[model samples]
Target: MASSLTKDSATPAPEKTFLGHPIGLATLFMTEMWERFSYYGMRALLVLYLVSGGADAATGSQGGGLGYTAAISTAIYSVYVALVYLMAMPGGWFGDRVWGARKTVAIAGSVIMVGHVALALPGQISFFVGLLLVAAGSGLLKANISTMVGHLYKGVDDPRRDSGFTLFYIGINVGAFAAPLVIGTIGETVNWHIGFLLAAVGMGIGLLVFLLAGRTLDPKSSQVPNPLTPAERKAVIVKGLAVAAVVAVFYTAVTMAGMFTIKWALYPITIAGLIIPVAVLVRIKRDKDLTPGEQGKMSAYIWFFVAAAVFWMIYDQGGSTLSLFGDKNSERSLFGWEVPTVIFQSLNPLFVVALAPIFATVWVLLARRNREPSTIVKFSVALAIVGASFFVFAIPLSQTAGNDTKVTMWWLVLIFLMHTVAELCLSPVGLSVTTKMAPQKYSSQMMGVWFLAVTAGDCITGLLGLAEVKMNGVGVILFQAAAAALAGLAIYMYRKKVDALVEGTK
Candidate 1:
């Protein structure tokens, strides 16, 4: 039987225990929130740490940093951030084929904790190695955790599903919202290594809580719905190990040969980023099990994915160039206290925390009234808004600041708010739709497919930030704006057709 209901449907209707969702929701919520705290905490400090100089702090010298040029620092940031999402492919595969989501999340969480701890140690070797560990761990954990959240729900059309994910996303922002204020301040004001340690402690707490809430999930919650035979498993493992070994050796050779530039890493990442997600969509559309309707939905999803990549490419600058601007050019006075530059990183997540509930409610009310924006419509709006944000910043480019000009804080504030609203319109909705439209057999893998766009976006965002070392910030912002506006316009023009394909879900 081609069951339209999800794998979890046979279980009893879940009792409402946490905010009108199941008790397990709370566990995943808390785990994800704290995990994000660690991730974003580290992220808020990463680029700043890289570009900082040493042996002085009184004159606002970014001393004690890695002391790299902005270009190289952002390049490194781009690659690390790209891999964080790119690795989700193999991580999701492992969960679906072998370890199951539970073990994958547990193992990945531990690895990330260790990575943060390593980052706290003083040395260049520790820094790179710690980044590698954290990237790999995040790959293994992120998509799978979102997959597990989907596992807790049983219906494709459950009214509460989007809201549930919305709540889960709110938890993510709570962590994100706090990370800049806590770890970012610590890294920026106190000591960089101490900030890293704070991140590690946050992850450790999340892991402990996850372990303690062991029974919150259904006994089989983490299992692969389509388990492989022993022969199949053995073949997959052998192939995976061989690939891993080859990649490790190739990168080692490149680094040793002094050929491992960001461009070297980026070229393949860009290629694979396109290949992976396009291939996933192709496979999904061609799946024998999908009804014609499902195939239509899959097409709509491809459009949404592309739209999201556009949104993220522009949005990610909030962490990179925007953060740099805050550190160097933006006026940081809030209530007459000079805010630490790291505080700017909090704006997106802070807005997300404030905006998500309203968006969630808005979606439901519109759905009930048959006035809901089609997902494509929401995506187009996101694109236009993201573009406008850059345009907004672009307008103030020459505003009388000679390496000392604090452009009105309102400029950055408005930009962050626009980006956040775009993200609210796009991100959680994307996560929900990935769960809804994905084939049951490849559930977690689809989440990975979605993140591949993020991987590409991060890479591109880095390149854009890197260009600021050579290019003017105003020109860069204008480029971003034009690109997003074009993409949004294209999608908006074809939205009626898109709406038809996405007929089943809002």
Candidate 2:
């Protein structure tokens, strides 16, 4: 008799625990982990290094900065992040139509390595070119890897699906946690170029792993299931070109971020980028009927995106405002050894490693009791925890005198601990939600869309970090608190509608 689970029969059955946890799953996990390490390692230092000039001295306040000004750095960071996710949508499309996931991932990895190498170069032009390359590679690679993971499981309901993704999720954080200590320390304390070079090395490892595994795993692993005919391919190419042209024109007009200008033009463009997808989702519901079951699943995805944006906005402060906070405002000595402000970036991932299993167990127990919170509820909690952590900065803000006050290292630890709890509630589950909810035919595209929320949130964090520099430490703390509150309220209010949408589809 056939097994009750459809996934059991979805493909040629493999023995249990192929290479310790299903061959396909293991491969994707390793690849993503290394990629995240490179990405997060850079992120861990980007804001701190920029705002503080360098990471050596404990210059906590705006007074201690390198002098380029926070506004300029924030603008550069925002544009870089925005472009990163923006590239992903097309990257996914390219993989689906022409190259397939494995090849696309390899190509993207190679490109990213080159970008990191460029960042290691010592010129403004190289910096710009490196960032551009990194963004392009991220766009191309991020979505495809997750889609490949889903393909490994064969069907959405596979019993191994959750565990497979869980393992993969762990990989993401492992790299994130390690980057700060390894790359951040070297870059800030020793040489900035060292960190960039390390990032390139991480990408190289990821590329090698993916290339080797692609050949040994499923024969159909990289095959495009649906090939477009000439006319259809032509139409897609035209649409892509048109979108690129329009976005390029829009970018050109508002491209004054380098000059520290946040123009009105960005508002409409950002809005449209978000709204167009919602419009497509609505159309899918109204015209396509898209099964209430499927609609509900996808609504969960939208909620995940919003909630994640909130969580990341706060979580990402580690590299931006928080780094500055640690530098000038907080006390940083431990057993006669002074800690580099950028090194604090390691806390969240460190906490993740320590706390992930606890949260996972709570979830499993809750699932057993049939009392698990909906994805939306968990996300709300994540936002609340993330937002609440900023209040801790307020204490230091009041105590410090632009670098005179010595705040305890424990305070930074406390804030990261809270953010860690919040992340545990959000990040891993968010990845799973996206993978499960999106249609198989559009898996990577939807994942790309989901990542756009992260990109947007990172941009917001940079903007707010700059605002903190301008308005003073207290102003930054209050701004973050307000954003978190707003995001939490929005999620709670919309919970029912979103829950219904997910339920109807499921």
After TM-score superposition, what is the CA distance of residue 73 in candidate 2 from its true location, in Å? 2.0
Q: Residue-wise lDDT of candidate 1 within 1-506, one digit each (tens)?
A: 44746555776875657888768889989989989999999999998888788321113745787877666666677768888988988888778777888888999999999999999998887988899899999899886887777777777577777778878988988999899899989888889999999999999989988889968875565687557899998888799899999989999999999988656655666566556666777877789998787778777888888888888777876776676666666676889998887888888887777777788788889889999987777888889999998888876566733445567777888888998898888887787788787766666467777887887777776665445452225766688799999999999999889888878676
What would the C-alpha RMSD of candidate 2 be, to one decimal place? 6.6
Model 1 residue runs over 4 Å out of place are 1-22, 54-59, 150-166, 222-224, 255-267, 283-295, 365-369, 400-403, 439-444, 463-472
Q: lDDT of candidate 1 vs native?
A: 0.80
Model 2, C-alpha of 259: deviation from truth (Å): 8.3
Encode model 2's per-residue lDDT on 459-498: one tens digit a residue. Answer: 6655543353552357767787778867887888888888
Q: Please give the lDDT score for candidate 2.
A: 0.72
Task: Provide the RMSD of all predictions against the true structure, rounded to 1 decimal.
Answer: 6.7, 6.6
Among all windows of ten consecutive residues in candidate 2, which has the lowest summed lDDT?
A: 56-65
* Residue 426 CA displacement from its true place in model 2, Å: 2.4
